[model samples]
Target: MSNKAGSFLRNLGQFSPLDPRSRTLRLYPLKFSRPKISHSNWNLRNLLLNDFDNGIRTSIRYLFQDPFILKSGDGSLQRKGISIATFLRVDRHHCPRRLSFDSKHSLVSAPPFDDGLKKVNVNPEVSGGAGLSKEINPPPISYRKLSQECNSLSDVLDIFSNAPTFPSSTYFSAMWTIAKRMSEDQKRFEKQLMFGHPAFSQLCDQMMKETRIMYYDHLLFSLYAMVKLGVPQNTLVVQTSLRMVQERINECDERCLSVLSILLKEMDKCKNVDVLKAGLRILVHQQVWKIESIFTLQTVMKCIGKDTSIALKKKLEMKALKELDRFSLLNSQHMFEALAAMNHRSVALLNECSKKVIDNIHGCPFKILVSILRSCRELQYYNLDLCKGIADYVATTFDIWNLKQILLFLISFENLRFRPTDLMDLLMKKVVEKPESLNMRNIIFILYVYSSLNHTDKCQHKEFLEVMSSALTGCLHHISSENLLKAMYSFCIMNYFPLAPLNQLLQKEIINKLLTSGDTEKNVSRLHILDVCLKLDKVAYQHAIDLQLPLPPPSLSLSHSKVAQVLSSLLGGEEYFARNVQLPNNYHIDFEIRMDANRSQAFLFSEADVTSTNLRRVAVLCVPRSLYCLDLSHPRGFLAMKMRHLDVMGFHVILVKNWLMEKLKMEDASMFLKTKIYSVEAHPTTDVNLHNTY
Candidate 1:
């Protein structure tokens, strides 16, 4: 039956394949030149090909791997050996050299590098060797074997360019396998090879021209490989396959539909595929838990946006929520990172993610930890346990932390409105120790932490500011307008006026951008603070962009009301204080009272419709607890500057803290007010001579 090449082809129908419907054919023994042996001792029974990815999906593994031998009567092919089903490996451009593995037949043209392939002994008991069959079957190339043998990009390209069939997913597999074994430099070249080289173009061209794909899986198999490699969705091969799938949309199941959506998103063509996305989300929701790759789920999450219907987004989120347990620690970090990057917030999901991060804190990578913190901050999540764990890990391991990492950690904690005390201390120490590592942006954050988080100032802070000031001044020209204002004003908050950096910021273009660019209202508030600081510090630089901040009409805060009550008891009536008085410069005062600098007597600025020229004026700026640094009586940069300006304007600035007034008993409150008001006379509001106690 194996004697003639034509006979072998003819007899293939006679042997019943294990799968009655198996389409895979065996072509291993087309070595059918009749060797004139009416063969004595050789029995060619039980010879077969091996199975592949599916049941009875056999193919050839020899020539590139171990070749199984089958023998009977006198010898043995490993009895349990599995042989792959071999077929013709066709290249329309070049004919492949042929090989035969029939009993007593040796390889025709094996490479010299191989020690040798085992020679088959079909008839050990038979005295003489069989003559070679001239009709050897062409060998099928194994992608796995090609990947194993190649050691360089050039070799891969050579294999690709010479004697190859294009539009094969197996080729994608081969490329990646080679890429994995390549050095980092070669791996980078692998990407450039696909992007800039002609070999890739030919492959894509063949994909476009090839009309032989019989199954959707073949096309999607290529898509899967591309996604894993981060291949650009704009690549010709990917675009062609996308069109193919869109054309075959009705035939595609959910899995293929989701894959198409992901590729379209990568192409930034989600709008073009909006209809597909609607259905895609539905299919993914139906099968969310079935998915095991969190990365796949993350990519799926990124695909939905404002264009997607809210109902569909909710469904997808809910399904993913139920299946979040499917994620590992690292994967959970990635999942929430995508959620945060997309600016999609889910309370339950983030809560779950916070727990995941904290639970896995000991093993977390710094990068993943940063991502987790971003999710929390961006989504306004507040998990104290997670915050503490992250802070502890970071503080203990901060030798490895870079400037960017420290900045992100600060921003996250600052946003969460939770002070990571140890982390903050460590950062302060780092700044004092290595001020050179800081840039303009980091200097702003450092100033902010000192200005906002530090209650009682440390000597290191002054040293930090001294070192930071020079670095900040050097880079002032390169900073953005918003950043310029923030850096200067943050220093103002810390009570160190950088006259040089401030002068640099007062340019016409910078001031214009500060007043006109993004978030102008917030920008102007910063400008107002800087203006107050500059004037109070008596540093002259003339780029005053006039701004009138709207003032609230006469009203009293609860703290002001509490202060009003205390003042009325001391000065004989509620009429002794006027509330919500706007200063000539338009800064609002919480209350105004007329008292001698001694505070032995107090009266209203306009009691009984008469001005009090005899009494020194007091501007009581009632501030919320948020206006102060956490757990401290220290006011933040803006509030501090406003007070200095008021002091310059001839009103002794008396801080009326809402936190203090709101809690004080009447007896103690009156005394507190008296002490606060009278202390202004003992030690006046020091503007020019004030040192930064931050």
Candidate 2:
């Protein structure tokens, strides 16, 4: 053992130093020395063996310097000992000038480049391999072709699994291609990519780092994919995708703009105001004329509300309206809704849109037309040509409209004061055809329009009133107090009441509720009930005397007193006249009289009687010729529709020109009142009895 140990120590090129204190032999320290190998003559095994002898202290640089050893296609150096097998394989086969290592075989082989693949030379600087002069570059494969070649989802996952090794653009391109092909099967694709496989999540993480350089389409595809995958909007993935869209919006084409619009709408659905604002800013700055861009601006305006600056809203509104001609019917309709929501009103823009609506009225759907009409009414922008066109369309297409739509159309027309009588008649016919569908509010609106347009005496007015009355009686319990009052008011204005049974039902069921309920905050008030009762009661004197309702004091002003004195003498004795009777709603009737049971009268003695009923036969409003000649359309005109609320409630409304009353003698005044009120054509009788008051 001692000799063997000594010999091994000697072979290790170590010398023993004598110990002075101890006479015994001590172990010497071993020294290691590498054997020099000739690079020109030695085989790879020898070099490897030499490296092994030195405990494998060889540097990668030294291995790369070997001439026989070729760099692998991936730029990695071949294993030192393995190069011998690669060289032998190449030498024996007499392979082509360029060789590639078979990764599976662990040996060199001839190039297996396919003829279909076109070789591309990648710049070394781009590849970050300054030493590499040339290499077998990968073919520029398109996403479409890649998707075609990938037979299964695993194949797609394989590409994503190796995403870190590939360039970001190449990886994103592959992903985009796969996503496009799988778009038709979005639910399946989403399941597999988002949940079924881990590679997709890993790839997402890697791609996020390179989002700044991602192409617009690639970003859009990623966003769409994530959205389809049901990713939460608050997630980093969705936020990154939105950021990428906003960044590239300016350079994007129309298709990209559309994608951005869809993205904004989705964000709006998510209530992501910040992201929506960012995208809208980019769209507005780009001034892209595409319809999608316009819609995006509109959506942002709607979603952000007052958070969106007024200046910004106006800018976007102007920008969107400039392209109104390019908008389709559906687009125009959506634009109108958006504008209405934003409360953006431009007369010129409204005119342009109105023209478009008129041109395409026939093609427009019922709901869309209703929306347009409502928008116009909300904006208070009434275009006569547009309204007439809508009316014509409604007249022809009334059958297709639902009950709600018919009511909306009619109410819009009434608001604009653009009465289309034919269309209105058609609407009335439709309502009568399906009276069961009419709710209390709809009834009120219909009656209101009829009264406003003065169509109470039209041919079908009585039949229409009967249908609405029946409908109202059936649903009296369900009617709200406000709607009930409005319906009664409408009935008064039209001067066409229901028959006895229906009238009693309305008075008992609807009017009783209005009188008792305490919801006076809304439009309906207590005074409306008084007017309704006055219109409903055939004999005004019996109603007042029985109900114990006090009459309003007559106006004692000079003009009113003069007219009242003449009216009193003509009708009967002064005791029959009551001055300025105040109703529950603060309305005052001027000089109401107790006439014969068949003809009850409430009189507005002069143009100054602002609260008198307009029902021609039930009430008389005497106005001077100057006042009568004024434009009735003016809000404050003496003959304006607003002068009376009781006209539509079966009241006989009369507007008497009293220009000659001031100059006439008492007998002349009596004759004038007789001819106007009683329709008396014969000479007056000598008897001054009150029996001739009728």
Candidate 3:
């Protein structure tokens, strides 16, 4: 070994195990060459001192550079090569523990690093002693990870509370994700947080600002959240947001249209008509000619009331018509309702809609079909081919519709004057199947339609009658007074007499209700009661069966002296005509005249008894002033409607105006009646009979 290396190894022998500082130093055996005989002349004391000084310098540098070491100023230590006793004294004050290394694994483990910095005081008189106060400051937490891993609303809220500022888009995305995964209880909790908390208002403000750049799905989610949060459509924030969307409608595609449609629908529910109109104006300006756009337009127009200007309504109608070819059944139904509400009719549009409805009848739902049918009825635009197709579809799929739908369908059929026996049979079969579902409305509608179509004979199905009678009896108290009168009127028209039990129930419930009521101004109700009593009396008298009900009072008669005088002057004399004459169908008229005045009795003919050859009778209707002024289009104007019944029953009708009788001299009145009734060319045989009567 070289002399310097041998001297360095010999200095390690001075340290003894019993010394307290000796345990801090760890030594390893070194293998050295014994002969560096050429360099063996070096001084052992000088080399040993130099080697010890180098070792001390290296230890001091390592200790200063260690990350775990605390430095007071400039990171400098005094007396670099201090004595071993001084080093041991300094280590006891600063370094509490020593580090150790494993030779086999080559790993080093140090004492735990103290990140808590202790404060030291320099003044000794003011402070009792040097105080060590440690302050802890942990690293900041990652909010991004918290947002992703959060499972409950509370966790998310806690994260939001801790975060000073977060990306609004990212926060909303996380919220929606959490909402979608939440259970019912969790959803309720979230609703509380979103609706009741102030943070949501800030979030909404952020959303409004960021909506322009936000993704379409994100925007939709934000809108849905706002709706579920019960944000009023008329609120400034909601209005501003909707207006912003409206301003950008030109860039919108079908997805935007869908969202806008939903928004307008909600606004409509809130009755925000001004906003709806504004949105509609924007939509129209964009000219987004799509079926969905048309539907939106129709919905808005309906809510805007029928007072919309003609020009704008016409423009919208033209737009809707232009897109009719692509409309679904629902679209067509909406368009029809809108047009009908606005009192606008486009025959071409209606025809196209009906064609589409017929094409899609099988896939169309019952509600849509009913709406279409009702529109057709209201507009009086009946397409025979369409009605036939609908009737066929309904007949084949009878069981799929509810009782109300089927009843409406039947009314539609009667209105269109289109009736199929099979469809009627199918309806009867349904009534028999679920009789319990039938209510008073259903029974009343069935009777009205059958009577209107002159098909009341078909209602005599034993099972159907039984079920319907029972349903009517059960719902007797629930039926309104107006509807009960209508039902009685319909029964009188159809000549349908229910079995004894239903007859007794109708007598006690409907008749007694009408008679005992103290409401004196119910003129219409009293008239209906009188008509029902007259028809029932005729029925019982003709059938020779007693219903045990008293006849109506004579004061209830509809005949007026003014009407009788007008008719008598027009019909030549009172002897030539019969007053209050009853027809074969139990419908009474003011006057009926025989072909020959010598014939004492006026002819009473059934529907089957009437023929063009045997139409030898002439009926005179002395309309009251009130009845004469009623609009023929109204269903309650029976005077105008009775003319049609008279024509169908093979009688040539003469309408004597009672107003003329009251206002004019008898000569002018007779002259006016002759011009209105007897001026027309008549059948030769009927002409002779009429000439003889006059």
Q: What is the number of backbone collisions in each predicted candidate, taken in the order shown? A: 9, 29, 3
On a 0 to 100 scale, what is the lDDT of residue 414 in model 2? Answer: 66
Task: List TM-score per model, in order.
Answer: 0.60, 0.48, 0.50
- Model 3 TM-score on a 0 to 1 scale: 0.50
What lDDT score belongs to each candidate, Candidate 1 first?
Answer: 0.58, 0.51, 0.51
In model 3, pairs of residues that clash are: 1-33, 1-34, 1-35
Candidate 2 is scored at a TM of 0.48
Model 1 lDDT at residue 671: 61
Deviation (Å) of 140 in candidate 3:
22
Predicted structure 1: lDDT: 0.58
* Candidate 3 backbone clash number: 3
Give residue 184's lDDT in candidate 1 (0 to 100). 82
Tell me how far the alpha carbon of residue 609 in candidate 3 is from the true structure, in angstroms, after superposition.
25
- What are the per-model C-alpha RMSD values against the true structure? 15.8, 22.0, 27.3
lDDT of 1 by residue, 1-694 (tens): 3334433343243222111232222222111121122333322221211111111122334221221122344533333334343422222112112222221222223333443333332222232233312433233355688778877545655666563442355566667677777688868877776655556544544443331232455566665566555565444345445544444444444455456556656554532244445545555655555555556667777776545556656765776787787768766777676776556778788778778777778767777777777777777666777788888888888878777877778776666555776777777677677777877767777777656554223756677678778888878668777777777777766667666877767767777876677888777677766666655666555345454443324334444566777777877887777877766655788778777657656665565333445567877777776666443444654576677778787788877667666776898777666666664445454332222221
Q: Give the TM-score of candidate 1.
A: 0.60
Candidate that scores best on lDDT: 1
